[model samples]
Target chain A: MTIHQTPSRLVTIADVAREAGVGESTVSRVLRGQGSFSKRAGERVLEAADRLGYVPNRLAGSLAGNADSAGSQLVGVVIPSLTNIVFPDLLRGLTGALDGAGFQSVVGVSDYDPDREEALVAGLLSWRPAALVLTGLEHTELTVTRLRAAGIRIVEMIDTDGPGLDIAVGFSNRAVGHASARHLIGRGYRRIAYVGHDLGRDLRAAKRLAGFEAALAESGLALHARELVGDRSSAASGRAALEALMARVPDTDAVYFSNDDMALGGYFACLGRGWAVPERLALFGCHALDITEAMPQPLSTMRTPRLAIGRAAAEALSAGSPPGTIDLGFELSEGATA
Target chain B: MTIHQTPSRLVTIADVAREAGVGESTVSRVLRGQGSFSKRAGERVLEAADRLGYVPNRLAGSLAGNADSAGSQLVGVVIPSLTNIVFPDLLRGLTGALDGAGFQSVVGVSDYDPDREEALVAGLLSWRPAALVLTGLEHTELTVTRLRAAGIRIVEMIDTDGPGLDIAVGFSNRAVGHASARHLIGRGYRRIAYVGHDLGRDLRAAKRLAGFEAALAESGLALHARELVGDRSSAASGRAALEALMARVPDTDAVYFSNDDMALGGYFACLGRGWAVPERLALFGCHALDITEAMPQPLSTMRTPRLAIGRAAAEALSAGSPPGTIDLGFELSEGATA
Candidate 1:
């Protein structure tokens, strides 16, 4: 296909040097605008390069050890999913931080698949990024092997529960779940139910559920019922799942959702059924999204340091700090929902 | 800084060839897994390369005219913002399409700044991507010059109100606004106001507003009031903007928002104030988001072909189609809100 067609013979620095009647080093300095060179030589080189349609190959320059080149200004970021607002918030924080530091993020979405992540890792590594930032600590064996071999800084963001390959920046999902469960229990939500999306792909969500169940055991109370939607988390799926759960277990006192998207749906379901929140049913969620906060009765949820985690990850990479975990922690919002 | 430190003496293919006791061509074929080579020779090359920690330089391979290499499997995508779900939805569709074709998307967010977009275009182009996908048709002169000089396929997505650079895949924002205004007018609402975010940066929103105003002129009626939030569009901003607009002009019978995010915020504001929707103040928005639909009264808005635009953009690039526009038209969802 033409998509794979090699670009028509690109104009190189040598060609520019010849056309400008200058040395190759002069042409290089003029194009990079780095090392000092004669102004007249620079003008001629630029003119020649522009005339020949020469676009500098930063990839080759990076390989040639141009430390201050634009090639080294890129940070490869691999995230799980973009449909969820949490991931986008993470990206916003990251790009914001990176922008001020003159670093650009080249992002890849793996859709929560380890195989795809491995392939993406291999593909991004081929670009020779200055650093690589991954969503979670968990990765395939091959992905880890490639990263180790690549010899670049690796920052794992959004979860700090497990040991990281290089650097980890985030709060504990397990802790957020534990705190959320404790808050519900303290409010006398004994027959609480749980509604979530597929926990198989989302390990962080699975960890939160584990901690939630553990907290329930501590209170000698367990979920009265649970509904797991087979699809990705969304308001529509959350509404349907909550409906299915309430149909089977009508006495559920409270419902805990995987995240704000699902929780918003569950809240909508309750609103549609004329169920009084916190009296007929209490609904809670993770990630204190703005939309959730703007709800008529704000949702009771845990506010994970999403933006902070992203900023911290970029800062850690830029700072070249020692490899370790940086737990920014989370906060519990006691809204009117619970 | 150590961040730019050249990786310590990377092992080259020549080293692997010497260690594996094979020719350089044999080592290359083994590493690429293309062309013919003995199985034993392949195993030896792989073992030697792995032991020496050799990662193939696809960038060099690309320059060397390897058409089927991973270097050519990259498609650079530059979006405006990720905080808005619209951008992420576009990415979701793009990655989904690119993934099946064994291509990975390297994304850059411009934060709605033309200067940032120009820099991002230069940065991404340095990687020699097979195709470059941009958000809108508008670009700085330098950005246009670079794209023209790059000699690669360029796909401009999301708005088709003007001329495209190479390929355009989206619907007319002006048409969407005209239809939306007509819909509200047909519903017997005249005292309509508009609430939006910084239209200076979001040109598509500006086009919609222009079209909305044009349609109103045809009906010999203009906006009763308008609230333009100086910040980016969000649910919180939408809520505050609506509150401010309603306070300034209480007689406003209907309000149109930039998108569902802002409209959802206005919906919440109405709920908080106990304003009966469609009876006291009707609300309409764009991008019929799922959360908007789950509200007590589904939001009456236009459903722009967001995901389809992303898919079509990728398809156009992959199919190596000729330079033109592919307008995947939008839909008008007549939810109960308006």
Candidate 2:
């Protein structure tokens, strides 16, 4: 059965009025409840409208036809994924601020795809939003062009290491990585392995890994072995990667995962194999997630200020004053695992 | 200094023609490239259009003027949260199917808030969507009334125990909870505690917890202790709750968390306090998330069919099928912890 059908000819108030043998003004008034109509005339117009399946145009609310031109009414946010709690925390701050200003924010997920980011930017700009809030300073050449041409405020979130396309709100991922590595080295872990997902997709993770390796290199100790997964990092993948790394490099005393998910996997793998954490093998991660803290052993990790980043992004965008950087720093949560 | 000003009025084709010193038909021809116009006239029309900031109306596109009528080209989806991987997985399926049908899906987050869901439904219905897909069977009295009156196809997802307000497509959360409890009990875990957040808000989590209690009660084993947080369940809250529960109920050998986040928290709490998981305490959760599998010892839990639920809901709405239930079962993954 046909769920819906399109009329052969467009039905309008004029058509309804003509069919009901009334003026267009009369039909419009009756439909909008703006003016009175004779009961007989109203019934005839209503019957004609029902027969034609005519729906009144509310394109003009109290705001009239001005709806489409309001640039500040729509805020466009482009992020990598919502699966990670960090993004949600960031949005909590952004939405809290923007909605209060009567601005409705729409989101697009690129899944760490630069081409997709470019495409999303083009689509979001078509709405002519007041601001574009994106994750990271890294962008494809096309994305940069469209964002610039869109002539809207841009806020790059979750990293403050490099020159931003516009305003930047986040911590230095490199610093986070360096701090993590330094913390591990300070704990007297000489040999360490790295387990992570595709750094190509998550540039922030790559920066963190680079800084981690740099700190280790300073002590004449490089990564013992790095086990990588070419997919989105999760607890399951982290566990599998850690298991594979242990079998390949059993001498490694500690392992630093790309994120908490991977670290949790490494932790579970240790539990399954009856390996004593910190004694036989140490495990460390980024993102001081609540789960990490709750694990039988709290995960040794860094807590990026996700909510702060989001709030700052909205504040910076709304200020419409200047383009600069705001470093929302990270905190190290030294749990029992490391 | 106004960051947000009331939007300016729209300039119609008539205004553009008036500014360009041309007839409306001639301006339309020049703008749409549908009919012939002099080069001078075309240039004049272009300049006037640019200066006036006139945008072509898409309301007259392939599916125009259906905004207030039934059979609108819109599909509305309401989900709990994307921060969890579940909703995104569901969207992957829904988008893959609906995008091909020229039906644009607009999403709203209820945040498990029934009042918010009710408001969103009213807003979405104003667009007169062809179909409305919402999460869960449980809805507010006002929500049920408005939806019933909306005269649109409705599909409630991720539940199957109760009667559908329309179409229902999901598995039984209670069954998943029961299975998890039975699995832990079979492993000789007699002293089991529960770690959860506001069950009143998240009905699915509440159902799981209820089923778990029912199963445990059958074995003459009631929950030893429960750490209940009157907020959304988070990993950090879960970790804290587990720690608190362990302190109060030292004899508790296992814990059934409301979901994976709580379970992960419980796992971390054990880690922080130097408790041996599975040996001293067993941790079980639901949603057999990817992170759970990645941890050193995989988390023993059930994996809900989130993608299937989403796909089924979209398909049912699209097909205009009668209201019924679709039971996409959950999976029990047994890891070393349980």
Candidate 3:
């Protein structure tokens, strides 16, 4: 009676259960909207909770023994960049699927640092997330060790060049790179240059570079010159790299950028210099992002299934599907530029 | 001794404390990288933790009474869109400052729904975040009530059209609107139209509309036509909206879009139709996003200090500053378009 009458202290699950003539768990399940409950019991619990002005602290309830630990509803997503539209598009697909399934995405950005990624993964693991979604397969040894111990549903999104920790959902960058190189070379571009930002950090970009070079070697050619910038990918960086590359290798007939950002920059450089695209120098990139399509001359790039990858990852996690790789292939857009 | 020797079960703090010959609280602080302790004590704690292979679960330690509840190190940042580059830029600014400060931003997207925002706020609050960073001042009454009760540092970013519940960052949308209207008017554009997406949900856009209209009224000219979109703002939406509005009010001199996405769309529409920009239909927008500036004819828009707002808010939060407003103003970029 005294416990029920204590107005100074906030109402707890015990108080609601006692008032409703039910166990503590019945109140919790009904309040959390998790598990199953009888209609009359749920009604009683709600009515009692309402009468007591009980506001459930979901964090406390999450760790409580009665709550289903598997239904934590938190999926940790660690990506390379939030600034890039690619990651956000992936997030959109993730939220689109997960929102209805009663799940929320907790995001962390690594900014393309392996050590930082390791730190972020450890921090996310501490949250005891239901699952983990990370970018690429590359991780510190310590990170791999900890993740193995965590034993959560691990997913590596966006790139499938190498092996994933557990579940991998995305296309093969190597294939995309080979295709891009074949397309550009097949279109009669011999003297080609590669322009990219921080290839060392973006391992996927490095993999693409390898694939491009391998395909180029098969055609008895090599890059005229490669310009690398140690910065985040952006149009400005792309423009600067293109300008420097053109200055260094004046005879280059085409340029393949790591991604669309550098490609956009390269395009801007052409516009600035009044150079006829493809007529003077051809340009190509990866990732068919929106602005690339919106450009006056549509960017010749590969359309990767960013959103589909996110949705598949989430749906699989929700369904308690076994660990496997899902390879959603890419399509090359042979636009006006190339 | 047995507690320290158990390999099947995870090593607990008790085992570490016993091994280190220190209190559990001392061990927790050293492990969590929080609080202060003697150098000798820290060394002992680390050695014990290393020998025992103790990986502290942050979620458990967060609510554990021994840990500092205030230093959760998780700041909840709720924004409208990750699709739009604006939010990401804001996040970049925030994380830039907060990263070095040993804080991680736990993000949630409201998608411009007040009801959804209220729900998200409730969910974020359950985590008992160190701070709550929201998009706008406008929130559901219940949201405000709950925020008041949460007793955490509350920050409203992006818009300053109304009184904030607590700390307000970013520029005034109303002022930006008026300034934009005046700039166009000063450039001798009389017939103007507005293209926006979901004004009812995006209160800031609505406020801008009000300011734009008010400034127009002073010039004795009302908008030629207003096209409102119910969908998310995108380049395609902008292009479609411009086409519809142009077909409806073909003689309109200039179009004010909600943001750069719509403006970029309008610009693209002009490009696609081979219509001359500014001469045929002037395009103006808020937010001088990256791609906007990189366009062939740079977008005539205001450059809001998105990054600065984020940095200031984080800096203040780090410093434990009092509740107030930090108004980072905007700059108008008079590009070739308008």
Candidate 4:
């Protein structure tokens, strides 16, 4: 087991300098190719460095090692949360392409906070990754500056409505919301309510709500009630929010959840309270998650192409394609719920 | 318009060397705090380096960084999949406790492969993470050696039967499997079949299957048929596996799935086929996921204390406690399924 293993200590400029019998500064200058040095001296230093197995530590300079490394190959992707199956499914597609091309991936989570996202972006950028793949375009001003200035490729995924930084790979949240509202309105459900998490922070959700309300307005009807929860969206929060929404607005005929997970929770709440779904309270949701389809009567939801989006983003990066938006499209599933 | 600007050209190590009127190697030595250097020289080098805002490139000599940063109130956790929701729920508790104690976390995904996990651990070790919090302890020999020589702390999660590398935090997988089998057997369900994915790779699932088979043997009932899929346990895979299993073994009265995701899939399959669950054929699964309980007929399964396990592991690391095992018990939910 005890093979002749080298000490694992880094071969620094000092080692090269010592071996070459020259000033350490000389080695640094020669390595950087900045200052003038005698060719013989440079040759001696290089030979000594090669013999000592000296590898330059690029960490000393932020940009020294990152640029021109086979292409913009290492992409730093920042998502809101991995707990959501959609994100991972997206990654599965993204990695399938990125891996084959020898591109490495570094990931960061913002926990759905714009401020945390900005900080995470800063940390990720320190690596000088080839490209930045962020969840949504709604980032802090500081994040925008750093990302723009970094001058690497930028791709904002999962939502495309407003102006993009460089590239956008997703459908319009506003369009999705409008479609959901139109679909519900067309079904003769007048007294409609909206149950969602913090939309102010999640601009994508806000856009969807705007589109939904716009469709409702066109139909000469307004939202019966809207309940917005603070912080991350989840089943428990969805259930609690729905309970509060229904309790406060008893006359609402239909409820549209922000996402399927929340709607699933709302469904459970209905089951717990001994209320018949669809007949008593029609429920609609987005993201046709497997469980949503698998539930006893199935859940009526809009299926977003999450994995396709991810795969497309990776493909764009791979091909070094010009920055633009791509709409993968969505589908509305009419299940037993609505 | 430039309230703050990041220049196109970064401040590199050579700038610090020239500013300090010292060799570049002297600046590196001071920043790294490695190899003997005069204190006066180091102070000058460090002062110049600080002014220049140099963050070292970790890619070069990353291993040394791991060796230096070990046991510094930072834990690196590598899990297989966050989509499982089990891992995130687990991380929620672990981070909650550790965050309070001034400990930070860095995470990596191994994608349920021993080889990927080995690379991730090596990467994490280079950062000198305080404690290595991994999903399971079934590691490659090289991974074991690197971990053993890591000289910090270790915590293996989610199963306890295997040999603990350092500290193990989980319940016995075998017990859960046996209990599930016994519960089904007690219900007079013979001609039972098991359906799961990648038992050969998923050590935990394999252990459960072994235990389930043992219990079946004790009750004079063996698996009527077993089907294994080659992938991580997923809803779609589970449903497909179940359909295949059912088609082959039409005489089977009950089926056991690897986890709730796959079980939900199987349940969905039953729904699609118009087979009355628990009447025409019983169903059983593990990990009492919240969605599973929301179904009309609650999932009859065991709720592993994933969060509790994570919390206990973090607590052990923060308290600087010695290596040992922590068993957070599992809850068996007796529903109409089996």
Candidate 5:
């Protein structure tokens, strides 16, 4: 029953099995890393594959299209930024949980552009991933259409401003803003300003700003000065924005940053100026990063459940949980800065 | 046209065309996101796809068993860690260069395990990526065989310890270790201890440690004390390791960490103990991260060409550079630490 296949043709599982003198299912199990195969059988298949220079035709097997195409055990994760410690923390929890459960993560960074997110979606969807984890609920029309059309689980993470397409796992960015404003106002801070990157591009940051303004209006106070930088949110940007804002409004009492990255930079700026923290200038940030806690004074920021959300999302996806929202609320870390 | 098709069957490009009243070529162009298609035709295809719930099977068109697969213009990048700033910086440079060249990045984290790396490689390769970028040269036997057999371009990155599978783009880890040791020894420090994670797991770090020990042996001196921790490199680990090392051997004058993370933690420990840097004990690290420079006293470390290597690897892969080693050297920053 030996069938001689042309070497020029794309190598198939059967070709590998025939070359290795094994059954088709053995080759499939060994290559796909599924089912129980003897170590000897695995080694045989690998040796044959190496000798024959066989690269399995993954498309024809795993991606043949349908509900049962031997689909991948990969959860496609799309986030805004990799350098942002928040995203990495989230990924750590997710991958840790998923890997333990024999699942994997294929990650993509959207850079906070909804259009780019749409493109990333198209490419990720082409894989027909078991489930997809997106940064927020905001997505282009085509992105929504494609996900619904693809009929796979969708998990929107980090923000819960609106109804999700499928599953949602995060606190409202607006709520984080309101809580931050309340904390700042409760601390008797007036003439407050903001230091952040582009609010328009980062829709969640924009929503937070709206919530901050609303909370501030309740106290009959408004932002005195604000500095908007480019797309990237960095400590350098934070320092620069603080310098500019202070120059424009010397009487400014406190500044709420978009995140801890900027706040850490502002801390350095204060260090350079020899300003007494919370005395000359108080600072508050979001996403209490590990680096933030390691600072001389713990950063006055909200401790969002980044890692918890990731783990929960992975667990839910693994359990084949129905589409719904799971609100993992944020905690206020009223550190020395505030 | 509009011949009704059963949704049960996996939709193909041909099906999309007939449903949209367009040619198969037009549907191919639109769905593959290549070449050009008229706006009207693209809209018609999308509308028809949306109406018919067509999920284009990427495997068929993108993995047509040859070089002509309309496979996504994505480069699959596999790295060791996400929290490690070095990897992220490298990714930033790579994605920037690749993005400008009309390519996107699909990333996976290996957690510094070769076995996990093999699994990641399998999943990523399933996409038939345009190119593959991996962390180091020390892949498992099967991984090497698989890469050689896959026929796609391979770039072994970060460390050039040995020969690459296809292309190698990085500095020599041994060279870095030698350089670090030379710099420290040149400054007349003999009683140096090493604080690192599980060296048995992290081959690159082990190489660096070997180079360091060899240099020390050449100078007729051995390490005073070495404290090994769990299989994770972190500032906390560094702090704890330094504390343990100091408690074990109080006379140690300098410390060489596996990377900047351990060094930063040691720096924090020095800060907590009210020990002046470079006076009480000198510190040196590898991979001079951005935060290293922004420190009150800039860290004394080796500034590896992380970003440059990434950009070079991307440009080379994009330009189809022949399989060869591109040695992007490292720089030693003689700061207050050492």
Candidate 6:
């Protein structure tokens, strides 16, 4: 009934050779599917390998200078949470682009924890991937050190506000925040408030908020109220935060959310409470998700080039491009909500 | 401004030893952080390794029988697509469970293409992972052959209508369809239509549709009308398909969508058209996504144990349990939408 017994000892090519009644050289050629071998010998070798569960050592093959093999075909990618649709969109673009170039991605999710990211980096690096693609510019000191030591192509994607360790492809978060604030202010929304998830871990959100506050200050105004949820951003949290914010600051006219998921929740809160959007309250969000666009009243948000950034990251790695920032700018949609 | 010239030659331990002015064994000891080495020797080795970009070959390490290292700690996963929230939810559960057991997931997205899945399987096997986790029970012949030959723990997740290659963890998709039909029928609704995406590639969705049709036939009724989109399921597609269905079959009293994404779109379409839900026309969907639950009127749908399936799959692999199907079961929610 045992599904699989963890092999007590690793299966070897020699074992397959012995079982197939072939020489080790013939067994190796057949298993690797390289060089010439008789059709009968190939069948016997495969059957023996299958029976013994002898997995071919691709690492050994790579070490033998097989440039087109497993090691060179892998690109290790590390990202934050998958709950946010943005990360998945990024992955779609990356995988789509990487697939075309005959490479596969090995992914790790860090859940916004620096220590987890550092460990994941070490683990992926040990595989000797052709390149490493990371979510953002920030990382633990150890992560930075290890990436530097790995000597692989390093691509820090979805942020370009600072210097990258290697290649950086994304729009500036500060600029996105600044534009959101300006759009709201241009429409004469003075009593603007904020609803966001924990900013301590999501540094990008923090950066965006900073830009928003700076723009507001430039206009001689400040946030009337704010609700900072201690958990990750979600529609449920956004709904609760909006309800709480409304109770504390009833006169707040406009609300800027950290991202579209939060804004969708805020929109739902207004719908449930019978608050007229843009008339009684205005809402703004970042990362123009498809759901947001399809809302009864499309959410007013900045459409960051998420998929494009992912594609660019992959393309840069495949082409072996120079290391620098590629700023694919954002677009502001003045949706009916705001 | 060359960021990195794809290392013309891989730096080896001997190279590090030469640069560090130390023995290769000492460099290896320092790099692996095993055995004993003087502090000065360790420092020199690290500096040299960093300067030379000497990546450790974990494949060789595993071949050398480092049981706790890379090969054993990896579990390769292949899923259909990431665009669906369901897949991400499954991954969240998987990574959350596997992380605790000191295992990391290497993921591949097959886009519901059996050929792509086959290639992905071969690619992942080269890494010599401890286990292989695949979605659904269906696979190409070569994929099945390779998985069986790989001799690793295999966990087929999120569908359990058929036999698994090894461990299977999920509810029956057919059962979900049947229950959904029964629920709608119990509500005394008839003249139901269906809106779905391409079923040719999504075998599980096809299974559910088959069950739904069977249940309908048992009740002496069949789909009053149906709309099958050639593209993948999405809210936008759902919305568009709903409009098309209503236009084509105005008398249809209820609609069953493939999944929550499509249903959400239908909901938005209804709102846009001022149609009262469940009164004018009822709606139902599969996979109870959070967005569906958080809607103004929650969606009536079947909630498959997606996360539980993922957790169970990981647990089975880690625990090395018996080879059998584990029906985690599903839940049906009759919300206001229906």
Comparison by lDDT, 3 against 6, better one: 6
Q: All models: lDDT? A: 0.87, 0.77, 0.82, 0.78, 0.81, 0.87
Rank candidates by TM-score, best first: 1, 3, 6, 5, 2, 4
> Measured with DockQ on alpha carbons, how good is candidate 4?
0.20
For model 6, residues B1-338, the per-residue Cα lDDT tens digits are 23644455567789999999999999988987999999999999999998876767765666566543235567889999989889988888898799788676778899999999998888888777889999999998878877866667899999999999989999999999888888888888899899999999888888998889889999999999999999898888899999999999999999999999999889989988989998999999999988777677889999888889889989998898999999999998877888
Better of 2 and 5 by lDDT: 5
TM-score of chain B of 6: 0.84
User: Candidate 5 A-chain TM?
Assistant: 0.85
Highest-DockQ candidate? 1
What is candidate 4's CA lDDT for residue A104?
52
List model 3 lDDT by residue over A80-174, tens digit each: 88777888878777866776686666677788988888988877766667788898988998888777766678989878877787888898888
Separate DockQ for every predicted complex = 0.44, 0.23, 0.39, 0.20, 0.29, 0.36
lDDT of 5 by residue, A1-338 (tens): 23433234446678889999999989888977889999999999999877766665544555543455326565678888876777778887787788777665667778888988897787777766778999888899889877776667888887888999888988888999999999999998988999999887788888888899899998998987898898478777788788888888899889999988889888878866777889999999998876676565668999999889989988888888888899999999988898
Model 1, A86-188: lDDT tens per residue? 9999988998898777676777888899998998898777766789999988999889877876778899999988999889999899998999999999999
In model 6, how large is the Cα lDDT of residue A20?
97
**What interface-residue Cα RMSD does candidate 4 give after superposition?**
5.7
Task: Name every residue pair that clashes in candidate 3.
Answer: none
Docking class of 1: acceptable
User: Residue A186: error of model 1 in Å?
Assistant: 2.5
Candidate 6 structure quality by residue, lDDT tens digits, A1-338: 33654455457788999999999999988876899999999999999988876766665665555543235567888989888889988988998899889677878889999999998898888777889999889999878877875667899989888999999999999999999999999998999999999999999999999999999999999988999999898887888899999999999999999989899889889988999999999999999988888777888999999999999999998898998899999999878888
Instruction: Name the better of 2 and 4 by lDDT.
Output: 4
Please list the residue runs of candidate 1 whose C-alpha ends up more than 4 Å from where it truly belongs after superposition.
Answer: A1-11, A15-22, A30-54, A66-73, B1-11, B30-54, B66-72
Assess the local accuracy of residue A44 in candidate 4 as a C-alpha lDDT between 0 and 100.
86
Off by over 4 Å in 6: A1-56, A66-72, B1-56, B66-72
User: Alpha carbon lDDT of residue A47, candidate 5?
Assistant: 90
